[model samples]
Target: MGFDPSRPDIHLGHVVGLRKLRQLQDLGHQLILIVGDWTAQIGDPSGRSATRPMLTHEEVMENAQSYLRQFFKVVDRDRAQVVYQSEWFGKFSLADVIGLTGRFTVAQFLERDDFAKRFAEHRPIAITELLYPLLQAYDSVAIQSDVEFGGTDQMFNLLVGRELQEMMGQRAQQCFLMPILVGTDGVQKMSKSLDNYVGVEEAPDDMFGKIMSLPDEFIVSYFEYLTDAPVEGQTVNPMDLKKRLAEEITEVFHDQQAAAAARDRFERVVQQRSLPDDMPVVSLSTVSGPRWSNALVSAGLVSSVSDGKRMINQGAVELFPPSGQSLKITEDGRFEAPEPGTAVKVGRRRFASFQE
Candidate 1:
């Protein structure tokens, strides 16, 4: 199992492969987690239309530390061996590099979809990009991996590893590819950069809410990839199925008690249109004006006044008065102050009430 420290957090998308690693570990196979400290500098070009930005060694190391911390949440740290590729690549001499390169040709490199696309489009392919698959192949050779796990996009690189391993007189390793998890948008692949990712570290309520918000069509896939819950023969409402999926996933990251509590909280606050028992209260003593955006920021509902304003314009900002109907704040300029007991709801999971 190899992963690059390109980001600091692990999302549900990465969990698919991690779960497979866990299954293998339980079957008495040794799990080797290879942190691509060296390969990340070159950046894997697979599934990319343009060159990826390079990360400094410091940034890569920092992300690697974060990756290990979060990785242990799903994988048993005691049974896994963690290694950095720099241990071998840093010691490679010019002759070693030449020897490695001599085993492959430019024609074979260009056969890669990423390189072929660039060549056809008259795009410049970096020499380092060409070397990425080779280095990745050498990783398996260095570790003498018997089996490698990755996403479908990495099939080419995984095959390269097998080829390189056989060239070095080692038995060819088997490749296991996991399906790409769809993002929250229900369209593209799940990614943090796209802000459509549900991180494994999110609060239980947040995790529950995000899963519940997914398109009805994704319930089955979410259950199949993220949980061991059965959905084969029984027919259930999509909403109920989604709820079950959300609770199952939340329980895996959290606990059964937390997952149940989150579900109850979501039902009370969202489905029932009632306030949460533990909703945060904000003191409005120093705040002036009926500026809903500023009040939202003061309550810590939005990150900034500008974000509050954007939410307001997007019709996501709502004011629920204690005795009256909930009012949606549409316009941005000054307005009358919200009643003392009014609770502000922002997006799906955040809520806060004003106090004197």
Candidate 2:
């Protein structure tokens, strides 16, 4: 399979292809991985709305190294052969590139969905971007691959590989395409750039919560793509199914114990309206200027002061004073500490306690 490490990590979307490759590997097929160190500079245009920003050689290499480590989490390392585009492409002359480009036509390239849309919208399609698929097609030739695995969005690039191999007098490779997994947003495909992705390397608690946060309609799809769990034809409630889906997926990447702990934490903190047992203890003075947003930031509940402020305005922040009447952090700009024993809850999962 030809892989361009456009991003550093493997999101669940990329796992679809990796899982298939592992299945094939288990069936005694030899795996040849072609890393797109050179082609990444051009950037693959598949499923892109606008042109992708080109990567420097240094950035591409760093991403490629990170990709192989994550790639092995699903695929076996001992059975795979790794080749880089720089191996042959570096040796190719301008005449060779011109000859390679000669075999394909502009009209043929325009047939791709992303290119067609860009053309219709009169978008600026970079000339280097046009070279992406052709470069990828040449990877199949370099490796002389028997089968190439990719997402359904990569149909055009994979087909180009088959044709390019035939033109080069090599056997055409089989193109195996898998369904793309949707992100937590339940709209776009899972992508690290989109920030809706649940990464394979995420902490168990974070991964579980991210999965649970998805729209209920996406539960079955997550189960289908990320786990071997059977959910089809089951009439379970969507909420229960969602938790099952989250736990199943969380267990695959983490241990069953970790998954269970994450589920329990979610139940206690989110569903039961109870503070977490492990909630951090901080001084009331940690708020410095008594800034509620800064307090959340210091507690590591939110990414930034602005996000903390937004959470407060959205009524996601509350202080449980000793009087048992919870006071909501309605004012984002400032906050007043009620009592020494007051407990702070931010959003649905994060909690902290104020000490004297």
Pairs with steric clashes in candidate 1: none
Q: How many clashes (backbone atoms < 3 Å, residues ≥3 apart in a chain or on different chains) does model 1 have?
A: 0
What are the runs in model 2 whose C-alpha is more than 4 Å off? 288-290
Candidate 1, residues 241-344, lDDT tens digits: the string is 88888899999999999999999999988899888877788777755447878878778898888998999999998888888998898877774566787888
- Per-residue CA lDDT of model 2 for 253-309, tens digit only, reads 889999999999988878887777777788766666457788788767788999988
Best by TM-score: 1
Report the lDDT of model 1 for residue 150.
88
Q: How many residue pairs clash in each candidate?
A: 0, 0
- Provide the TM-score for each candidate, comma-separated: 0.94, 0.92
User: Using lDDT as the measure, which candidate wins?
Assistant: 1
